[model samples]
Target: MTMKGLYNSFMYAARAHAKWEIETSFNIIKNRKQLLILFIMALPLLIPAMAHAADFIGGKSAFGPSFFSPTTFYGSIAVGVVAGLITGCIGAGGGFVITPALMSLGVKGILAVGTDMFHIFAKAIMGTTLHKKMGNVHAGLAIAFLIGSGLGVTGGGMINRALFNYNPVMSDLLISSVYVILLGFLGFFALSEYIGMRKKSPKGGDAHGGPDEMTALGAKLQSINLAPMIKFDEHVVPGGRRISGIFVAICGSVTGFLASILGVGGGFVTFPMFVYGLGISTGTTVGTDILQIIFTAGYGSIAQYAIYGYVFYTLAMGMLLGSLFGIQVGAITTKVVPGTQIKAFYALAILAGFVNRLFALPEKLAQMNYITLVPSTAAIITKIGVWLFFGLVSIFAFWIIGTFIANIPKLRAESGYDVEDTKGGVSQ
Candidate 1:
């Protein structure tokens, strides 16, 4: 009789435990669902803030709305989705898209850049998580780059402030002009690179470098006995010793300074540096560069927020959500598409964006011409042309969205969509 009683007690305890477990799980799931809903609700507020600010909203509040329209949220959504799709295909941050989209809306350049940095931080983390799992991201390399870029950020910021404080108007104009020129130059190079690469046969052999070659350039630089040598395990250099301390510092400083001064993430410049200067394989360079950028930009975002208060949380949040989806899609597309063709395509897209920015030569001419009626007509024509171009872009934009939705099934069929199966898989 006593033993029977003990068995009943044991069963009762087991049942109680199972019930508790079920309730806990249900609560956790319920919380997650609520959070997701909140995040979704926040999207509208965030995307516009990132893309164009209130200026994009067609309201009169210091910033005037030219490109940003209250009527065009749907249009921005369409553009954002398409941009996400394209970035996913190319394996890159969609800033190239977001910046232009925001600029089109007449967002102040500084605010657009500050807000974009916030979005990039979130997107980079997402990409890093997935890539790390696939053995693509090098955490050690990331840390090393951070060490260098962290310092660069400070240096760049100081330089920027010094210039602005000394002469705000002249400094601003010079900086913007330089950015336009740089974009123009890079665009040309990208075009050339695209044309040359595209003409190559589709059946070309894989060009990923050998492990020994990964740090050959860095190793050679080590002979100089430069102070502050950082050791990191790079992708191609399998044995945990590649990239000298000095080289990392140099690279970091350059990237940070450029990013801070120009309000850019510096991936375009750093991407090539890793491949050509450091002699890292293309794939390793990209992964490592992103990891490094996350740290650099993460710091920059915080700093910019504190300094300028220029960030529109709404814009940052929206871009983050959009980018989260975009990066995943772009990373996935990298697997099925050939890298060569994608490279050609992305290069062309960047070039196009650069040209759009460079097209402001008339405004410069007007500024020189004393803003007279003759120049006023020129400015008006330019503005109209800008609108017309984006109008045409909207059509292609829809086509891109349709294409992405259409490919969902194919994306699912191909396992591990993050792989850079294509010739030019995404470049952040």
Candidate 2:
């Protein structure tokens, strides 16, 4: 009798959790309406930034000439296109390119960071909520996490401002150094993952990092029970247990701080943290992540960067436009290519970014007089790294485009639908 009762109780809890998820989804849609207007209004202002030439007003906003030309406009498009292609093929690592790309174009480091964050915020505003996946979001978890993350975003923003205030060259050096460590780790892991997958047994388990899998950390976080326990995803936990708000906030703080400093949406990091660090189910984590990004990026970009005159609006918009279409095109090509090839490109692409950032660091340090080097030598080395970085990205993007074109017939036949390549409308 006791065993039977326990089974029934578990089933009931699972059902209740599912119902709660469904309710959450409805709320998300209802709230998104107001945000849509803001997205619309932001478009016109961004369009003008591409063509206007001005030095960053007051000189405090950034060191770069505020004036832009066709070079800045078209160049941003090209970078965006490549980034989008990468994103579409691999479903990740899109944010890694923007900061470096902008900086390499002679934009200041602070401006690049601020611009990238703005781009992310703009994109998030336009992102799809039409899928009705909102049910997977846990409001309680999101709210608690936001509390901690809010502080982190503020703290990180201040750190960047302080650094820029101290010395421009020092700021560049610091930002570049951060990128080197991050991209190096990201690229190495990507390479390792790709190589390991090739050697894996056909019947073996997934290559998810140990962090993606539950660990002692997740267990410890979940075990803590303070006042006002927040219950989320009863189905996953069997009994719909509660997590302390404080614990969730701490997790949020970690993600928010990194996102603010790096000028990214933080999805790449947050996904794993929620799943591994906080013991949240992957489904709920994804939904909650989307919710947090909209807030975090918006707050960080506007309050921290834009108000301080650190953002380049035109560049942000150009990247946004280019990446949007690039992602779509890349997504279409994935249907034609083998998955392994895509995986290889993912690793190689990041490594290319790694190389680009690493090579440029010496120049930044040289600028700060932290190292003995000729100015010309530093310039030459940086130029070479920039060339290599963009060269690799463009090659990959073109290869995908060419391959997709070559395989069009096969893809069309497979799908049993022909897309007309007209002069206007959907094709150009």
Candidate 3:
């Protein structure tokens, strides 16, 4: 496919995934049951606090050493807030930056990945109401997909663990390399899209518009009448479409593998693969993606990472809490910000993450002896990457929060709420 076509596909997928995440965040916070469950899950962390503040902050005990330093605790929340802001404002998946941000904050690459997975799982469990959306789900298709995803998760987890056991540097190298490849393509395209939009429309409207059409590849895939065909979209298409279960399973495997290795929950890619590759209708794709993410994230985090002790429950909970608030504020701020600016910031944020991971490579390479370099010089480069990444994200977060605060009166007026009356505790 052409670069522009690829970018469009990517954005479509990301927006769909972001929509789910935003909804999930809202649901988790709004529902008392979910809030109670979340609180219960977090109670164990407080047990450490009873001993001594210092004892809880990276202290060792019979159970294990805590990774609960104040810096890391608050830092993880900051990371989640920034990510949530990007997702809410840009209308695209902000999760791409989470693992990179954590790694930059001195988290072990494996631990970062595992913790991210757990965070996603927690969000999915608390926020996703699959029963309400199951009308659009094709049970057979979901089953086939999960079957393949399960195997993929296993393989990916084994690969990461094996690398870590062999050499921690190697594991970091692998994860960083993956991000470099993904973010490099995405960042370059995002920047290009921003420039193109600026030229076409001074004040950009919607970044993506137009109907979702089946791609040529999607058509070809659907034509393959292998046995055990999984039919779907009967509600949208007259006769509905059928694709081989094998192809569906293959797509699931790819999604699961990426989720396992990257901790992104694989929702970003699932939409594109279903809509563009498998010829699935957007309606069906949406519900199925939701169902799958819960399973994929839960299985990957608990079965693959948590059991092995890679998942950081404290960091996961902190991110969950921060993202809930950040998404709401960022979503509100979108009413005040221009689409062009939002798109531009999204591109810059992604490119910042790209630069961060890309520059950190030298240090990993030097440690692994893959490249000879002065240790001090390598450290400096790594520090530059970390500072640049965090600096850009922090600025974006502040800008969004500032915009939200400044626009409260306007937003309230638009919502037909009297600002003066609210100050007096009246709702006239």
At residue 424, give the lDDT of candidate 1. 52
TM-score of predicted structure 1: 0.67
In order, candidate lDDTs are 0.52, 0.69, 0.83
Q: List clashing residue pairs in candidate 2.
A: 53-67, 54-66, 54-67, 55-66, 56-66
Tens digits of per-residue lDDT for model 2, 199-314: 97345543332233455667788787786689987877577756788878887888788778878766555655666566777677767776777678899888888877787876
Q: Model 1, which residues run further than 4 Å from truth?
A: 1-79, 125-144, 158-182, 189-203, 207-220, 231-244, 279-287, 324-348, 364-374, 381-385, 388-393, 405-428
Sorted by lDDT (best first), the order is: 3, 2, 1
User: In model 2, what is the error at residue 141, expressed in angstroms?
Assistant: 0.7
| 62: Cα error in model 2, Å | 6.2
lDDT of 2 at 278: 68
Output the number of the lDDT-best candidate: 3
Q: Model 1, range 164-275, lDDT digits (tens) per residue?
A: 4564433344445656665555446546655766786535543222233535454566455555544544433555444566676678788887776665566655654555
